[model samples]
Target: MKNIILTLALLIPFSGFAQEFPNLKSTRQDEDYSFLKNDTINKNWYKTMKFLPINESKSAYFSFGGDIRFQYFYAKNENWGNGDQDKDGYVLSRYLFHSDLHVGKYFRAFVQLQSSVVGGRIDPSPVDANPLEVHQAFADFNFINEKSKKLILRAGRQELSYGSQRLVALRDGPNNRQSFDGLKLMTGKENMSADFFFTHYVAARDGIFDDKSNQDRQFWGSYFVLNKVPLLKNIDVYYLGYKRAKANFDDATGKEIRHSMGTRIWGKSGNWRYDGEAVYQFGDVAEKNISAWTTSINGGYRFNSIKFHPEIGFKTELIRGDKTKDDSKLQTFNPLFPRGAYFGLASVIGPSNLIDIHPSISFEITKNIDWIIDYDMFWRYSGNDGIYAPNTSLIYPGNTTTKKKIGNQLETEIVWEPNPFLYFRLEATWFQAKDYIKASGMGKNIFFTGITTQIRF
Candidate 1:
């Protein structure tokens, strides 16, 4: 424990002087600090550590950085009081350190180490603990590097996040983030970009360095994005393929193979912003024809003239569900890999076989502080199908109950950023059980409160 404390101390910044530093990316691998290569502009206290020219060559260099995050959750009536609940709460701590080495721009190497821990919990899941492990280790080779266009090939283990992260994500909100072992080819220009990737997701383990890729599960996808569309500011199109040897759903458990095609359009004009996405899926589940789909649209209007500059937003989603468990065709939508906070910080529910309407409002209380509140109402798309967890696993069985109303939730969060290197957040959630929850299982309301502190250097 002492060693862990000592390591986290390194992530604290003595001064908030990172304003001029390279902007941090969601996945650190995409960050570029090459501009610091020039000696004339490299005159910051931390510049020396950020950019280290190898033997004065300047062409080849090294950069080092990391972050420390600690989160605590106090959940009441977990799973609507159906599951075990800790009396007090649980704590999740994560540490990440990385090094980037550039070999003459054409070739580059990156490595990251991770340690996540969970404490005071009734049951610890695999993702809640991984004492220590290699989070990401990858190499990149640039096939074409030019002013107008560029292409790069990357291999080994890495984190993949794209679009709105409804389908594929890094699981950033979880204690132990997800990583994939595979290869990716990326090509892009000023107005367009695309990625082709093939990989197997690594399974999380509680033990140290025991994580490995799941051989029975494979994922491959191609994603394309076009910027500055005529009516829309941006457009994204993607095709994803997934295969799992043994998959379990609300109905029978068996092998599954699925393909998804999706399109997204997003843009902002004046004080109005909109984001819309639609997806269609087709495949085979135990040799049975599979068909499912989902559509989501969100719009927000910023009240710039109002106090605190509040932005009112509304979002709606409809995810297909199987009409019956013993049906000839499976219609349950699969959310491949999605964020943990699909609904709110409680995140008890997932995006499958359901419909949700969310209305929210956010305020910029100050230059460094923000607050948001949202309400979501959920209903099962098909009463014959059950509700799922954030990981797309069945949680509440249909039990032949035909009730459609599941529940409603109210959530609020506040974030404070004193500087560029540190931030603190607080969140609370309440979910009210409805007819379905009462008839199927525990009908208790779920309450959750969370506090998080993150430090980056």
Candidate 2:
């Protein structure tokens, strides 16, 4: 079943390609060359000869470009539980490949594949195995004005970035990108722009889960932004609304739904850059009525080859339990919402289940080199009593019983760019927790590291 699904997915893009360039005839010499050479020539020949409009200006016609990346990671103490263990030492953590293809003045496409190994296993789930997965497959369209101003209309699985702090990022599509079947419209002028987007959910893949069950999920959201305000030169403002409905096969048997609204303001003055954001969420999870809020602030300064950024953030929530006694009515708080990576080291220590305060600094070492250092502090505001709680024995704590717990994390990374088309990155981290929150089903005082290389054209 998985093989059949994979075959179908692989053929879908080819089908689209065939429809888009059906009339082109191949002039390659050998049959084998036809297959291999066809892949490269089809795109180039189509763009140059077939797609170009006669009498069109060079800039008005079509253009093509793309990028690719490869990555690997090395880690120590790889035991992520679930009946798995990692010996203390070095290990190949990941192998990743990504590519992007742009078409005409308005269309773009991208795809990513990844594989990894840990604890001597050849294929592990994203949490434990080595596998190959596609990260993106999308297209974009741009609109132009008489004066050559820029406007854009994009659809398919595409990425989005907005807000001063990315608080309501429905797509979470960067570093590890998340895309959706959606549409986006935007317009921009010198140093000013606005954008709007709508998206429907899709499955997430990262070397985990069998392909059979990897069928796409469903979700939808809308985001908007107004940036580059003149009142505060170098400043921007953003607003976003996001909604996500649980997938059909989600683990939670009860209805799982979420809605988020947020706003952000940011700007730069001379060598200083400042930003802040706030968000509110309302929804039902596992049949539990839920409400939540979050906020963050950040500032930075730049000096020639060196740059520094520092940030802080927080989250709060209200939950209502099921009505029936047997259903176990309960309200829980999740601490990791606003800043999952608050402490650089903790992000590496274990899964960011919840509860944290984070701050960090990043620097540009040179034209092609850079570094970032960050720290995280954690505590439980409310939830089940056992591991995530301290100073209280209540089996099921309410919002009132929640208290501050303690944990800290540190992280650092170095990036190297050899040229416009090539680059490398390395990272390391350490974490420490004071109570069961860090040890229960999660790691404690753990360490991790990773590396990646990329090329573009």
Candidate 3:
């Protein structure tokens, strides 16, 4: 039955002619590419929405943009727990407004304001709620602009993300995106660059002007990207440091300081592509030595000659776990600021102290429509630790059981882009529990469904 379902999914996209869709890429392209990168509005979308039109004047050096989104989610047996309230539904709405101003050839300013709200019967978590706040505000100054070299300095509240977004990201899947209060410096040209930053995460509050940089935590990092590496598409290397005044975990709680260093290499040739990353961490938590690591690898192939331009890929990852409760050192890996949807649409699990194998396939139904299907299997790397949720919350403790096998998940998603300014998506997922969850009194099949729509102007 699974084979039949996958066969049909691979064929659905070839049923009709290819269509064109608007590009929805992020606004963080390299500065050397072009200053008008964000101002290049799509001509196929509504054009009359421009009010000031400074974007149309070559000398004006100012631009404005915004986005609106609506999302709804339904879940059955959330966290594999049994209860009437475990099955729930919720809806979220978000609005973002931003502006950019440039002065002469070296200075620029940017600001973004956002509002997010929740509706429906489900309990609202921190990710789903935040009303009216400054999402980002920053100033940029260029130190060099030669053909072969470039340097930039930026300061104030901003967004930060590194390679692959497995360990660091802006949290785009949630209603309220994440931000940081920081200073950053970038060096190098278009083909190679390095970023150095010092910052603290901005905590989202439910009220205006109440959002503040987390005083108890500090972060610093340097990331390098090499666009042209031999035998590969590119390479990434980074080092990050994190300190928290007080931290908590299954076996301990106290001040913590952690350092992480990692490298990633990825590339594509012909019809095949691949990505691999590994990281090691060391620190002190609760006066105990901390040591942990993680490794991930993913590869895929595209069938261009097939009807739908289908692609299939497999991913495997292993994260370290604490050796024993009596040990003085902690071993669970910590993904500091990972993407919101790191593990597919359901996002029920995090990359911490566990092992996972994921197989996925995607189809380009048309230029405007796409479909994706994923299956994942989970197991505890150390049966003595616990299972952590995508939010880094401890959902099941080690004392709950010594079982290793956790569960399996299946998910499907469809995305539609009618024009450059609008997009829609629908997704559904199911999870089947194994002995581990059942032993913890949280045994049950889980289901999740959601729909989202967004418009840019």
Candidate 4:
């Protein structure tokens, strides 16, 4: 499937050129670079930095860009379990290589590769898997007029990032990143823009082999944006719609196949910014009819170098119905839908799949450095509950009659962004849930820390 998709993507650009389509945006003025525009063509700084010819008469034009990254981490109590005899101190390392090639105005290609080391082992076992794989491999065709004015068409595997939090991200390819395999159509002029996309499955990992399921899953979504409203300058209104089919082998067994639909409204107004989202899901899980809903509101205030953002989010199951009578208590709530995938952290920590409220604040110390502190409070209702386990394969024998109803967690992080292409992030989390870990006799308090670096081009 990967080979076939790659072949088709590569062929599309050639077909566009064969049809006599001219290279777009090759001669357009980039107002953002005023220095280059003011200087003489021969003495332009950008012209001196350019290693390739700038003449349109040249047979070929090529642009080169890529990044390499390295990361290391330290953990106080890596194992969030009992103070037992287990290796809890070790140095983790990861490396990433990414590159992009743009040829004239007809073709563009991207490639990403990653490798990792755990506990001094180069190629660790599955339990220590660090996702060493290819993140993206695709070609693009620009089918828009040279003058930036109207409609545009982009096809093949691509990234579609819209709205504030990237909830309906089609191109979130790979397990770690995210990407979509399909087509995207975009059109806009002035301040209004509209986009449409269709994809197959949400690739969660890097390599083609690390895809969630072997069978191709169907997915489609669309987004519309209106920017710079008259009274709401610097503000944008967005709407999104998406539907996906489960790709697991047991999907036929109704093991929580997801049918999700959601929308969001967000933008910035001076020192204050806000975003809100709502979603609904309907499906059958494990022969039981399932329906659920979720909503969230996030707002922030910026003061000098400090920004405080407090968000409240919630999820509920409206149709537990008669299914609860026959199935085990644990089978009531579907594990597929968590609070929200944001900030690269698990939103809530508890069972019942019920409710969560998170509040966070961040401070910037320097131009390229910042810190974030957040807390998440989780509440689970009776019937069924959920918890995070390091290894899902293990089953624990425990009674939930005495389970705690509230789980409190604290998370802090320091982020350093030296440039657009490179970033270093360090994070630590502490949580307490009496019944969080069923196997561990003591689930009172758990702490863990991780550090990572990323480079993109």
- Top-scoring candidate (TM-score): 1
In candidate 4, stretches whose alpha carbon ends up further than 4 angstroms from where it belongs are 1-60, 74-99, 103-107, 114-132, 145-153, 164-175, 202-213, 229-257, 305-354, 381-383, 387-399, 402-406, 418-422, 435-444, 454-457
Return the top candidate by lDDT: 1
Pick by TM-score: 3 or 4, better one: 3
Better of 1 and 3 by lDDT: 1
Q: Please give the TM-score that candidate 1 achieves against the real structure.
A: 0.96
Q: Model 3 compared with the native: what TM-score?
A: 0.89
lDDT of 3: 0.79
Better of 1 and 4 by TM-score: 1
Backbone clashes under 3 angstroms, per model:
0, 15, 0, 14
Compared with the true structure, what per-residue lDDT tens digits does model 4 show for residues 1-457?
Answer: 2432443344343332222212212111111121232335455322333223345543233333233333343333333444543344444444445444445565555554544445543333332334565544556565653444445455554444555443443212111334456676767767767777666544444343464421334555566666666654433333333332331211123233455565656676767777766655565545554455555667777774334323222222221111133353223333231223232332223222335567777777676788888777654443233333211112222234435344567888899866444456788777666443533445445565666554433
Please report how far candidate 1 places residue 24 from its true position, in Å. Answer: 1.7
In candidate 2, how many Å is residue 433 off? Answer: 2.3
lDDT, model 1, position 82: 87
Error of 4 at 133 (Å): 3.8
lDDT of 2 by residue, 1-457 (tens): 2432443344333333343433321111000111222334456543443233333333233223333333344445443222354443333333334444444455544454444444444444333343554434455565663233568776665544445323323221113333356677767765566776666544445435322221233334444445556655444444444333431111123444555566666777776766665655566666655455555566666564334432222222222112222233323222212222323322332111245556666666665677877766655433332222111112222233233353566778888864444456788876554554334444445567665544332
Each candidate: what lDDT?
A: 0.87, 0.43, 0.79, 0.45
lDDT for 224 (candidate 3) = 96
lDDT (Cα, tens digit) per residue for candidate 3, span 341-402: 77865777788888999999999999889999989999999989887766566777878888
Tens-place lDDT digits, model 1, residues 253-286: 7899999999999999999999999999999889
Worst 10 residues of 4 by lDDT: 23-32
Query: Which ranges of candidate 3 are over 4 A from the true structure?
Result: 1-24, 28-60, 82-88, 146-148
Best of the two (2, 3) by lDDT: 3
Q: Which whole-number lDDT from 0 to 100 does residue 404 have in model 3?
A: 90
